[model samples]
Target: MENPWLKINHSDYENHMIEVGQSQILNSLKKYCLDKYQPKNFALLGCATGNGLEHVKSNVTNKVYAIDINQEYLNKTQEKFENQIINLELLKRDIQNEELAIKNIDLFFVGLVLEYVDPKKTLNKIIETIGKNGILFIVIQKNKQTTFVSKTKYKSLETLSDISNDVNENEIDSFICLKNMELIKKEEIELTKSKSFITLEYRKKE
Candidate 1:
């Protein structure tokens, strides 16, 4: 089976997301965080082509770290935001890896990326990489049992509870375990023209 995250084309997906207003999720995330902390540096875990970067406050944020596993995605993001002059750093990294070049992040954004990684360890790694009291804004697909095929494979809202049953289990509960984090705020949004839903999970250091 092919890895879905690796198969994503950042440029294409970013363009589509922007056109469809799917990128609004990033804007919402920024608003949710800026309301709480005055972060100087921001890290976007799955910063695909840096689509919604323009929404980030330039004066408050001096640097933005964009990390993705696909080199093509990183390259596309770098090229797209090359002239933004926001000190953007495009990094090609498998987020599952424990080692990272940067740490003590002020704000960490994980958007629609956790479902593809080992959720438990991924959350722990994210918490470990950020500073104390730092903010983590995550947006994950809620349902995974009823697969739907529009342009991608996803689950229906009805089965969300079943799939998330073991919130503590390792393999079957990728989405719900995220809620175990010390939540600061959370909201649910239904996608346009899809059977999928998004759960925005926000957290602060415990």
Candidate 2:
């Protein structure tokens, strides 16, 4: 079966898209965490085409594990960042699958990926994989409900809140509970002609 996350087709077109706005978001995320301890091992979710891979300082990041559901996108990302020599391990795995091997992630970067999966399960897996002192950087989209279409399924920020509400009732008291993780910083940015973006930095409890 084909993966839904691997949606981009043309490499040039994807690169253009990244160059325009995605790169800006990636830069903002990097700047927020650059002062933190240099991450030796980094894991990125929804790493499409590896455009932001180049932004990660080589001296700080020795190994990077890029995960995406689509094999095609993974292949593209691997080929695009092959010369970086950062021990990039491209894995084709579904985030919902609990059997995947992921642990001790110094920095876990998830951008516009969680909306596609079961938010509660995805957060549990992420919290489990990241070390006690590790950090998680997330970028989520916010907008009006009518902006989304059936052909392209994208969850709004309110939808994410709803998912968090369910998790709070069934599992945790709050999605961004300070007991488990503490929010260090947050910034909201607007895109060219779409929804707003919010980047959050969270430090896991020791």
Candidate 3:
């Protein structure tokens, strides 16, 4: 199966997210995790064009890993943050297929990525990389409309509709609990009249 994300440019993705009023909200949510967790080692899964990376403080976060399947996205992130962030690593690998080499990461952020991949397989890989007591911040979209991809001027984003799937909160909770991770908090942010983002924060048991 072809990955639609690779075909879409960062500009188109960002524009679509902005059109749906998700760019600012996503950035704020990522900032919230950074402030609350205060992690020394931070990892962002499916980091698209590094939208929320501006909030990372180099003094607090010594190492930052930005992983994405698209090499173009990784390249853009490197061009933007390579000088600003200390010890920044950009990985071009699919979370569903490749083994994540990151270990002992204090915080892992998975935003709007599970819908495109196998949740169980990806979660297993995530658990392997998170350190003891590591924090996991996951954001999934809940749609009131039948279409998973919201209408936007950027037609390139329409390709994602083929792979995107709606994820249930209860199913995610059950999977994480079985892995010995406990939910710290959960919040739902309404993006538009027909769309909302559900964020789940979990901590690995020591």
Where does candidate 1 stray beyond 4 Å? 1-4, 15-21, 31-36, 144-149, 152-181, 192-197, 200-203
Q: How far is candidate 3 from the true structure (C-alpha RMSD, Å)?
A: 0.8
- TM-score against native, each model: 0.73, 0.77, 0.98
lDDT of 3 by residue, 46-158 (tens): 99899899999999999999999999999999999998998899999888789998899999999999999999999999988899999999999999965899888899999
Query: What is the model-wide C-alpha lDDT for candidate 2?
Result: 0.66
| Sort order, TM-score high to low | 3, 2, 1
TM-score of 1: 0.73
Clashing pairs in 3: none
Q: State how far residue 181 of model 1 sits from its true place (Å).
A: 5.8
Compute the lDDT of residue 130 as modeled in candidate 3: 90
Per-residue lDDT, model 1, residue 56, is 65
lDDT tens per residue, model 1, 1-206? 43455665555565556654567766676566655566787888877776567666777887788888778888877777778736888888887774557777888888766666677667777766777667777776544444432232322322322223212222323443344445555566766534344444445545
> Among these predicted structures, which one has the highest TM-score?
3
lDDT of 2 by residue, 102-204 (tens): 7888889887766566766777777777877888887776554434221222322223233221111213225755348877777778774555667777788
